[model samples]
Target: MRPVDGMRVDVLEYCRVLASQLRLAGLPESRVRVVVQDVLAHVEATGEDPVEAFGQPTDYAAQWARPPGVLRVLGLMVATAVAFPGFWLVLTAFTSPVPWGGAVRVTPFLVSAVAGAAVVGGVYPWTVGLWLERRAGRRVGRGRSPLDAVVAVLTWAVLIVLTLVVVQRVLGPDGDGRTLFSVPRRVLLAVGHGGMALSFVLPSPGVQTMPRSPADHRSWWARVRSLLAGTGNRRRF
Candidate 1:
């Protein structure tokens, strides 16, 4: 049977539209382009229309599955955990002790907070990428994929720095001798984080989740572990 005019219009064009929507949702434009191109290629090779091909998934349960790429999610979780500690320090900054036995008369709480943020900004994405690849039943590429890592690191870092700025303002001014540090100190931290983040905007492996092969056999341990992992966990998030 001949395909309809809509189907013949070109699958790549449809992919382009979808990629644009993904970009609007805040995904990196370059990464979206790559994903669109790959998906379009796959569809073309199968000689199937996108809507018809993906219309009914065989594994509906796996669609929302949270296993496999759990590491990526865990990085975000750790970053959240670090934020809590920073919050505690900020709330108690006035009573918080100065560093190195009071040699520096500054808000120790804010310093601790920035340090915690640095940890989140630097390492979160690499771990997340590893987890994502595992979830897709694929081997994660080693060494720094660099681009996606930069994106993940920078996004979290900027968020952390911005949070610290607000916290600092809430703690009061440096001239009053109550702040953890001066505005200049905070500015330097923000600059460092921003520079690190800009390094991650390029498309790299482990950022996009790919479908796993259904025919692949799982070991008994793998099957058991998979069962323990929740099938779907992101509907609310």
Candidate 2:
């Protein structure tokens, strides 16, 4: 085999080992796929040695096996904090127009209690969690862990409680019908998630999860800068 072919094999072997270790560690299959996705993206982006860039497969998986990073977990929690309230406020638009809105009006103390409960909740409510939820599952039977259940329960509970509080505060004790109607929040969320889940039910004709690695995957701002930088051709014209 050629030198490039050997390198490619080595990378694939490394990915396999990493995936096996994570699965053995009881990390969910979806989460394991994400780790592989990240590794492949990094490898393709910068042709650095996989071992050099990110140690061994078992070591990387071990870190995930261990408790999450303190600050990183806290940051995810903060995102969930903002997102939960935002989702509720979005829902208030619908609930406000209907009757029996007064009963749903959450007292300030109840708001504080629910937020506090969510703060103590053990959940990864940010990017990773969102990614896992969106990924379509093809298999018919899969047993979920209690931790996954806890995370999901805490997530929904937080959103529901947060909605009540924001709805009451903004729309008043008896919610006014006037609100943002351009988008129906609940229906949008349901349809979007449902479609995403349904996509995985049957084999897709020509869809691959992660296709060829892009030459550049920089942020929008970075791309904008490059686009704005003229190559002196504009002056020539």
Candidate 3:
């Protein structure tokens, strides 16, 4: 390979290793992408080897690694709970014979699934972080120890078992506490489709826009005007 091609290969390998280390350090995927992109951009600008410029990947990741916040964890739990039922509701919209505006009964299993999902969503990050800390040789915060991993795993297992027991025994098959709420199938369909559409249009928090080039500096109106001028010139010719 040419010298430039070799440098490119080295940079790509470096970035791949850096991204893996950053993830193993418990940094969120979004932050990991941003950091990796920044590093790649710097390397391209200066044409320096990534290892020389940024020390080792693990060391660099250690500098930026951080645990996710409480609010983020809570939000994930809420989203998971909501999505669990929302998916079923959407599926039922197409399959069920119930007419629009008719009430659909919520089952105990659905509620249990939502509860399970919420539990998993909340506990997952911390558990994964504990494991990552063990792998990365870094402490997340104060009061954390190697034993925390074992404790977290045990707690997670217990919670899962309890959820399953509640689903099968306490809830029973069509028990009195089965029906939680009722909503129209049409409403469910609308909400599901709308949410899906919004997700496509909305920019995620993790997405980073690349720097615009000189050509992209022109406004839409300027581009339109230029197109019109070119068309007029073509007609004159």
Candidate 4:
């Protein structure tokens, strides 16, 4: 949290807030950095307080914000939800000893996986944005507390238990659901592998390429420490 040379503490704070706001506005890290650096350079040249120069960080960022489209968000969520079932289909195709033409019943576990993926896809973005927003407002030099970790773990555990309970209740002891369609095992295998390969080549929606950095060569522990300390290259301002 120490300010870089020639950067005041308040100016550093302003940069942090601006970066956070830009990220919350759905700007990629690279774009956020470019904007933040421009602001920093302006403040440095004029020797003006950032808030005085640019107004509130949130308001300033709103000018540049391009919120993702509803269709794009929904598409991402559907893609995420399908990934689990796709993986399961591939695994089952490989392992099942049943005849190639046999029908595969949709099970409760599959249903649960889809439901979990949908929930996660819908909630994860907002949760992360809120977490980062809160962190940005915290006093400089303060890191995440142990209680935050505990609460996060507990929340996930509760969600998992509840999902399993509900799935079990609805699906009963047999955990069976109606058969949707039948396909040959060979066809399933081919489709599954093709889907997996396509997933690797496909560009994820809303993701922007990150610029290369020296930190990419650092050890995992070093990277973890930098992240925990909030002292990455992007934070130098």
Candidate 5:
């Protein structure tokens, strides 16, 4: 492998590290490969190794491959353990006896119960994901965190509460059970389920701390808009 002048690393090794990070960041493999090649060329022009210019060896490895198969298995196990409470709440929702003679009352207790499920079930997985990304420098997968389990239950709870609020507003507080469980409620529930799937199914964002480059910069207008929006401007803008 050819070494870049004034750098102690091989060109291929540098590309390997860059490509690995792009992959972790949830970029498509084809796109990541293309970006890695472009970065390699950019560094070659300056006679410098891309990996050394970008980050340390451990950072590159974590971006590309770390935690191995065993770590992944353990991480998933931890996630599953954390999500148990939410799963139990779901079971309770369907199996437990209805209160107030099945009147479908939108009670505070019910809302709190669901919220508790979300908190209990989501905390561990979310923490694990955050920890892995920060300390291990990798994006933990959905099944790899307890928070993954809570996403669906929490989404369900939020959707249910929102739907109930809308319904109560439209039909009044004394709305009957029949109206509450009607076609409209069914549609809302379906939407909630879809949201749950989306929240969990998307790939996790990877750990990233590399300094931006000229190529990484975006248009000034985009930057201004992102600043105003107050959403994260990590990548774009």
Candidate 6:
């Protein structure tokens, strides 16, 4: 691999470590993801190693750690480990046997569930562990520390299995008590395909958020009027 590619991979690995440490310190996953994105951008822009640029993960995590009390810590732990993952799995279960206009065949049970998860990942990417982590981060209190994300993954592995079960149950053959099961799964597929399509059409997220040039900061009306005045001046000359 090229040197830059190697650095990028190392940086990505470091980001995972930083994220874990940050979560252990109690930062929510959304904040951690954003922080990681920012770190990536910074590293790419500066062409520097993350550790050299940002310091060690442990020390960096400390910067974002929330003030700890027993109550808040405990509450956040439950929220991350249980409530967050539980809701998503239930939602995932609801989405099953995603239709694809017969483009891709979905087998029953294991194949169906795996296909459903992949569909969710391919188009919508909602099944992504990182994205889901960010979603869980939404439940965190603004006042709480960000390291709670560490506890966030505590139950995800198991929850993913449960999600598979739910998808199976939801996708069980119709004309049985399973009629309502397909509704959620269809929605999941719809969302997945729709999101994937939209991704291609939309501008890149980084570019959308990129800082404007200093000159672009001029008031828009002022800019227009100035342009007009300049045009008239050139014409007169």
Q: Model-by-model lDDT, in order?
A: 0.43, 0.47, 0.55, 0.58, 0.45, 0.46
Q: How many backbone clashes does candidate 4 have?
A: 0
Worst 10 residues of 2 by lDDT: 134-143
* Candidate number that wins on TM-score, 1 or 5: 5
Q: On residues 1-237, what C-alpha lDDT tens digit does candidate 6 reach at each position?
A: 022333333565556656655654556655776677777789889888776677655456567885234564444333333222223333453444445432222345434444444433332222233333333232221212355444334444445566666667766653333223233454445654554454443321011121223224457586568668875233211
Q: Give the alpha carbon lDDT tens digit for every residue of 1-237 in model 2.
A: 022333433566566656655653456666777787788779889987676677665566777775235575455455444433333443443454444323233344434434443443324333335323322111101222456557666666666567567656664553333333234445534543443344334222112232212333556675567558853223211
User: What residue pairs clash in candidate 5, if any at all?
Assistant: 79-145, 79-146, 125-146, 125-147
RMSD for all candidates, in order, please.
Answer: 15.5, 14.5, 11.1, 8.6, 15.0, 14.4
Model 2 TM-score (2 dp): 0.30
* Candidate 2 root-mean-square deviation in Å: 14.5
Clash totals in order: 8, 0, 0, 0, 4, 15
Ranking by lDDT: 4, 3, 2, 6, 5, 1
Report the lDDT of model 6 for residue 21: 53
Q: Model 4, 54-95: lDDT tens per residue?
A: 766656777788544566555544555454345656787777
In TM-score terms, candidate 1 sits at 0.29
Give the lowest summed-lDDT range of ten residues in model 4: 205-214
The residue-by-residue lDDT of candidate 5 on 1-237, one tens digit each, is: 223344365555445444444544445654655556566667768875554465543355454444334454445434443343344333434444454234233344444444454443444333444344443222211113556547545655665566556545655555233332312333334444544454454333232333233354566687678778885455521
Predicted candidate 3 versus true structure: per-residue lDDT over 16-131, tens digit per residue? 55565565445666676678778778987998877667765556776897433566545544554344344545775676566666876667866576467546544554445334
Cα deviation of 89, candidate 1, in Å: 15
RMSD of 6: 14.4
What does candidate 1's lDDT look like per residue over 1-237, in tens digits? 223445443454344334433432345554554555555667868887654544221121123232324464455445444443443333333343444233223464556465555455434433554333332222111222456557666667666677666666666554545644443333333444444454344222233433223333566577557657864232111
Runs in model 1 lying further than 4 Å from the true structure? 1-39, 42-106, 137-181, 185-237
